[model samples]
Target: MNKIKNIGIGLLAVVALSMGSCSKDFLDEELTTKYSTEYFETAEGLEALTVSLYGNIRWHFGYEWAYGITLYGTDEFTNANDLTNEMWNTYDSRLGPIGATTSTGAANGNATSPNALWNEMYYGIASCNTIIANADKIDDEDVRNRCLAHAYFLRGYNYYRLTAQYGGVVLQTEPASGVVRNFTRSTEEECWAQVISDLRNAYDYFEGEVYTYGKGITWTKATAAHFLAKALLFRASERCDDWNSSYKQSDLEEAIDACSYAITARGGKLTDNYSDLYANWTGVDCDIEQLDEILMAAGHNADSSTSGRFGNRTYNYFTPQFSNFSGSWVKRGVWIGGMDFQRCRPTEYSYEVYDHVNDARMWKTFKTVYGVNNVADATAGIEAGDPGIVMILNTKDDHTYDSYTFGASKQAPNWTDDAGRLPEWTVGSRQTETSGSLTAETGQWVPNSLVLYQNGEYVASSFTSQPICNFFAGINKTDDGSRTAEKGDAHRDVTMARLAETFLVRAECYVRLGNYSSAMADINVVRARAEWKSGENRSYYSDGSQAFENNSLNTGSSAEKYIYSNLNMNTYYLSNPDLEVTTEASSLELTSFPSVLPDEDEAIMTAIGASSDYERALNFILDERSRELLGEWQRWETLSRTGTLITRAKAFNAEAAPNITAGKHELRPIPQTFIDGLLNDDGSNLTEAQKEAWQNPGY
Candidate 1:
């Protein structure tokens, strides 16, 4: 971060660089000329600045910081066992006002610090201020209005995030041209009011018209309305209890109305298939930048040349170390999914919230199978296409296999029943080992299996290795197999706002308004999309099939390919007997509030002490949000706004539960650099007590 006399000055220094026209990359812009006030007053300079704001949007969604700030320390995710970025997830004494100074320091530096986000967002605000102040220089009315609209939306978007993370930060709407240190905090209410006002201005300028540039990555009327609804929802939430009583009802109504414009009025219908929204393969049909459901995204190009320094690294997190297993059957980089960064592992609560039996999302969103990739494993009758290890996410005893014969010869006698069995080895108990002939045979069944984990517990295995961070379930949504290199640029655009979240936002409003039936109706709309339709192949998955097809480039590789190329892949189970009761759409819908939370979910709600009906309803919405939007960067704000951060963290997040405090942990401490660089508004530096007073309570 650039040190300055004040925080605003540090933010303004980057405004000149952002006034350049965009290059081939949507996020790459270089300053071509020296800074000048007169140059920015020109039409070309102003338009160029407006274009740069699109690139600036990438900072919020592109890198590891995206997950660190939102997903970490929340119930949806915890640090992997092997992960070093523990400050954010653990919320220990290290998560202080100074912020993380390096990747492996006390914390994870900018990735997990409020410091970097604070500076970058204010820099963006400074840029937006420059554009909004000078966009009038453009003579064409249409261009001028467009520039203003973009500026307003970007400003509101940045402030919305800042306010959500650190309540009532120094609100600056004007561009700071020089160093100064007279800064003070505004009330949380004032910050939200300014954000709402800016968004409304952008909405009005759009005039219900939708314009998309850089594919579907740019802002539109729908995007403005969606965020407006979200901001209103935040203000209407319990976090605003001290000052929200007078306007809570109106804010909820307005939020619902804004959602109506974004969802129904403006062509904001969801994609027919949930897989379509996150088509991660490199097929021609995998284009997702212009999908109808995505209101806005952070765009990245397929061509790596223009993908900027860090091109959408959101794909690199949330993965387990599948390549580091005990057996020789699995290898790294041969498959299309990302490298095993293992920074954002899902919590036990994250997996339990899903309606695993009826919802297709559990099967669609998580990868539960790893195919044999090593050539040497072929001798065990486990060819490259064979299912190496299958994880059945069930707790029922009937779903398990009775016995297994491990390290046995090829001529092993009857490794359990051979008739009417599934495609591969099943998930079951190890009751007995069968006697077999000592000699091996060609093209005969043999065992060289790795351990298998079922429902976060190690149920059975051929290898004696213990299951830890290396065997947890992986989220399939950020799976990017299309990259040419192990750490290459990801082509998929980072989804920001989509129709699914819009529906959930409305459902939450109804819940707060005491309209349980209406809330369920809205909630069911998203759940219905998550349901597995009748007669659909249960074993197919889109990403897996594409990965297998890609693997076929190696000659004679026997990867399993899905028969239906058009439809995405499903769970590989042929006849999952336990899930038969609720495998279709109707079975997935909730009839009313408290419609039976899963066992783990019910336990968390209990720990949170939701004694009242409204309290339980809010907790239910939080669970639903995790099920639908786990790794999408929404958890922290959702928890914070509902004032459930402390309770939920205590209930579900093991790492953060013991260390997080109620009042202090709700909002991040204001960055220490910002606090240290301030003056007392009278040409004198702030005293130690003054600095302490300026920071958030407890930190």
Candidate 2:
């Protein structure tokens, strides 16, 4: 990042050129003009600078501290198999002055956040102020309006993310013309007013115009409307239940209106298939861009040249631990996920939120099955240098058949169902103990067990639908083919705003407004889209028939099977199942455990009828978001804004439950280094006690 210097006109112009574009294609153009501040005071230069904002600001939103700090340690996630960021997960004060460094080297130097997101957001605000203070320089009418709109939208977005993180941030409306020493924290009301003003300006600029958006990747009127509603929703939420509050009756009305407009006017509706929303495998060859459900995304490319402008490091951070000490699991640009970088993993609660048999989203959201690489050999040991396949087995039904196994073949195994043998066949994907370990028991890796009713008795249940990897897929990079990639290797566009999240935002507002009926209606829309059945037509917007329901709940007895999987356990299963015997789910019925619709749901859904009105309403919305928007980087802000952070964290987040308190963690503490550097309006050095007084409530 540039030093904390003045936003000079010359430097701003160079920023416009140097940052370039964030398109699917690389910015390969060279500057042909000896341009200065005077030359930049034109339509083309302003447009160029607007594009540059996407490249620059994404560094804050797409990379580590910018987004990661808000993503991990929430109800949905914790550190995975590895102890990554244990301090943060445990809500230790290491998140603040415990490691505050004033040196530029304190941070990675790209976008400095010596303590939290202070330096980084200020850097973004500085650029936005530069564009906003000089937007009128453009001669063309449309050009002038568009430049101002983009500057306002970017500024509003940055402030929105900041307030959601650090609450009532330093509002800088003017350009940082010189070395700025004086810094005053704005009140939540004041900060929110500025956010509303900026987004309003952006929203008005794009009113009723043909949406010629920024390369189909940047924000438009649709984006502004969604954020405006989101900001208003936060304003009306418990975040504003504070001293000097400014939440008006119109807060709810305006939020509902704004969200309704985006839903109606924005073309970003839900896609037919839940799986399509997560097709981010640019490096794994599924290079499809999101259009139906996606409104705006931070653009990226497989070519790593411009990755610094828009790289998703957390993609690796959130992936499961897939690599060994030797790092043999990946190649640079082939794996869709990661290499043993288990920085963030789904908590047990995350996996439990979904109704797997009914919710197609569960299967789409996580990579549960993988091609087992028989690395020793596809067929182990025979006559030649290659471990050859045995053409024929002794006999199964006293019949002889050639076992075609040297290559891909779907021929069923000819081996008898021996009580002491592991089922053998070079075949299709199946559950395994580990990523590539030669064991049929998924319990060694994921908890793979079943609870079912046998022909006449309550008997041992064979497994189906056990969770393989937590959250999204980790890494399928086994280095077996020409296509091999490493952690965070894919440079696909990362989604930031989409319609499904908008639906959740609207639902949260409905619940807060005491419109329970409306909240449930909105939630049902998202849920109806997620449910799928086996043989339904895969047409547009069709919610297939329910594959899982209370088939025999009226009887209300343990005579029926209760759906069991790794989700029922808190730790990874240590032993594999006895594969010598197995039972099929087809022979038994699967029902939701502690069944919410039946008596079985009593264990987990304990507060069903006993919870307070607010608790019941909020928990439903939280679970719906968890079920629909898992690993989408919106959970922390949602809980914090709703004032449910403490309660939900204690209940769902195993890592942060012990350390998180009621008040202190609601807003992250402003870095002490930034506070110590500040001066009052009178230009005097602010003292420590004074700084503490101005800081967040408890820190």
TM-score of each: 0.84, 0.72
Write model 1 residue lDDT over 1-699, tens digit each, in one string: 111246445432475544332323343344454756666678977876777777666666556677878888898888774445578878877778886666336533344566868987887788888878877689998888888898899899999999999998877777666666445588899999999999998887775455534344568888889999999999998888989898789999999998988897546557767777664445322556567688877655565433555466777787766555534445656244666777787766776677556667776777655555664544345555444434445432333433433334212112223431233433221111121111111222322222233333533322222223444567877666555566765656678889889999998899888998888888888888877776444455555225435433323332222211112322334224344422234357776566565554566677778867788878887888887887898798889999999888887787788899888888888998878777654556777887877788889
Model 2 lDDT tens row, 1-699 = 001211133345435443543443323343333555444456666566565566655564444563356666687777554433455566665556434233422222332242645655555565567677778777677777877887898888888878888877778788654455345677777788888889888998865534443234456787888899988888888767864244645787788887787887755357766655662232322323436466667665544544553454545554443322111211122212333355565654665565533455654454332221123222322111111111111111211112211112111111112221222422212222222122233222111111112232221111111212222332221111111233333344556888888887887778777777777667766876776644432111110001112112212221111111111111011111222221212111122211132222222245334265656666667777877777766788888887877776787676688899887888877767666666665566666667677667767
> Candidate 2, residue 311: CA error in Å?
2.2
Error in Å for residue 314 of model 1: 1.2
- Residue 527 of model 2 has an lDDT of 74
Q: Which residue runs of candidate 1 sit more than 4 Å off their true CA positions?
A: 1-13, 16-37, 101-111, 280-286, 303-306, 376-379, 396-468, 544-586, 594-604
Clashes of each: 12, 11
